[model samples]
Target: MRPALHAEEDVLLVVDPQPTFMALCPDELPVPGAEAVIPVINRILAGPIARAVVTQDWHHPRHLSFASQHPGKRPLETVDLPYGTQVLWPDHGVRATPGAAIHPALDQAKVVMILRKGFRQAIDSYSGFRENDRQTGTGLAEWLRAVGARRLFIAGITRPYCVDWTAEDAAAARFETWVVEDACARLGPDDALDASRARLEAQGIRFTTADTLHGENA
Candidate 1:
């Protein structure tokens, strides 16, 4: 049987549903099929879930994660950073740009808070809870705790990175975390997504489809 999400005890987390991350737009880094997930996310938001939070990949024009900043290196190349293996990407999610804005299809009015991350010029932020440095937290966990959110339901663009990292961190923070699989798009290879699923499963994070939730809650 699927668990029911109580409004007061559960919070819906939308991770980086921005134009910069969607293939539907000609943004610097668009994830394939990212546009398709917006409707799925909206369906979840319109369901029984009440409170919600959204994360934005708000980066600086000269952010360290951009490949253009490093001469001779193109986007999608892997470079070792002080943190670990970092995938160099095109400059994206620059603050004040249209690409940084949330997808127009998303119901932003329903979100209680908008958490802007990756604004640090020197670091990259994948997890809504923390920077890639793994120590610099965005205080998402604290906010969730303060709001009395005991469980977290996550949905968004790019499954292998942001969504995966957020679920891992949320579980580590002692919240019952569940990822709505169909509500997310993968930016990496299938193997990467498979590995991420394994990692999340090991941490006890649950996975479900939007249809399952809608059927149970209906």
Candidate 2:
């Protein structure tokens, strides 16, 4: 049987469910089945969870993470930054753009906090907990701790990157973390998703489907 969530101790974390990501076309940086996961996430939000937070990738137009900022570089290519390997991406999540807004289908009213990340023009933030530079934090950990969140229930777009990084960091911070498998989509190759799952599992992060969370198969 699957474990049940303790409403007082667990918090729901929705990672980067913005229109910039959810509405991506096949030719763009589309996460396979990204749109289909929204309903699942909404259902989870409607559950008895006591607290919820949302992460937004609010990047600047000319952020270093954008391939366009670097001449001769293309999206999906990698460059070594002072921090580490940085993956170049098509310009996205520019502040004040319609795509940067949360998806219309999501119930934003349920969220208690909205953490905007990657606002720095020179740095990229993939994890809700920290910037890609690894030295800078978004203060999510401190907030979760203050609210007595002992476990984290995470769901959102592009599992291999954002979701994966957030889960890993949450686990490292000693919070029991679980990724709602059906509530996330993968942006990269299939192997990337598999590898992320393996890495998270090895780090002691749990996985459950939306059905299991809803007690449908429990």
Candidate 3:
């Protein structure tokens, strides 16, 4: 039998489930079928697992990571920043905009933390625990440790980026991490997804489906 998830032993990390990435926002960085993850995540939230944290991108207007901030740059283009090769993105997650808010459909009743990140104009944040530079910390790992959480189940919008990075960081921080595949939306193709899976698996991150998590605890 699969190991059952316990409330005190396990925690949920919902990464960047904002309207900015949903199909409704075609201009701002929409991920295909991103809205679908809400229900899958809601099911997980409604499950036996109790403690949870949700991450928000929360970027500022004209943030440096945005293509609009750099003249002649386009979305998905690569430019070398002080940190490393940075992928320019369409203006997204601007604070106080409707797109930056967490999707209204997501259940937050069990959420204990609504962690907002990427608000700085100079840096782009992908992981909940750290900025893109990888040196500056967000203190999420410390918060989890303080709360005595050991097993981490991550889910949310835009897999292979936010979800991938968060899970990898969680694993590196010594948490038993699992990524709920079906609960994550992606902007890439199957091959790209496969590549991310391999990369994450190599880092000791495991994968599961939302159905499996729900059924196991049911």
Candidate number achieving the greatest TM-score relative to the actual structure: 3
Give the per-residue lDDT of model 3 (tens digit) for 1-218. Answer: 24488877799899999999987788899988999999999998887788889999998898999999889889999889999988999999999899999899888899998899998789899999889999888999998989889999999977888999899889988999999988999877889989999999998888888778877752
lDDT of 1 by residue, 1-218 (tens): 47787878878899999988766556588887888988898887778888889999999899989998889999989788888888889888999899999888898766998999999998899999989989999999999899899999899967888999999999988999999999988877789899999999999999998877666662
lDDT of 2 by residue, 1-218 (tens): 36667767878899988777754533335565788888998887777666779999899889899999889999989988889999999888888787888888887666888999999999899999989988799999999899788998899977889999999999988999999998987777788789889999999998998777766321
- Candidate 3 clashes between residue pairs 3 or more apart in a chain or in different chains: none
* lDDT rank order: 3, 1, 2
Query: Per-prediction count of colliding residue pairs?
Result: 0, 0, 0
- Considering every candidate listed, which one attains the maximal lDDT? 3
- Model 1 residue 99 CA deviation (Å) reads 0.6
Per-prediction CA RMSD (Å): 1.4, 2.1, 1.2
Prediction 3 TM-score vs. true: 0.97
CA lDDT of every candidate: 0.88, 0.85, 0.89
Model 1, stretches more than 4 Å misplaced? Answer: none
Error of 2 at 115 (Å): 0.3
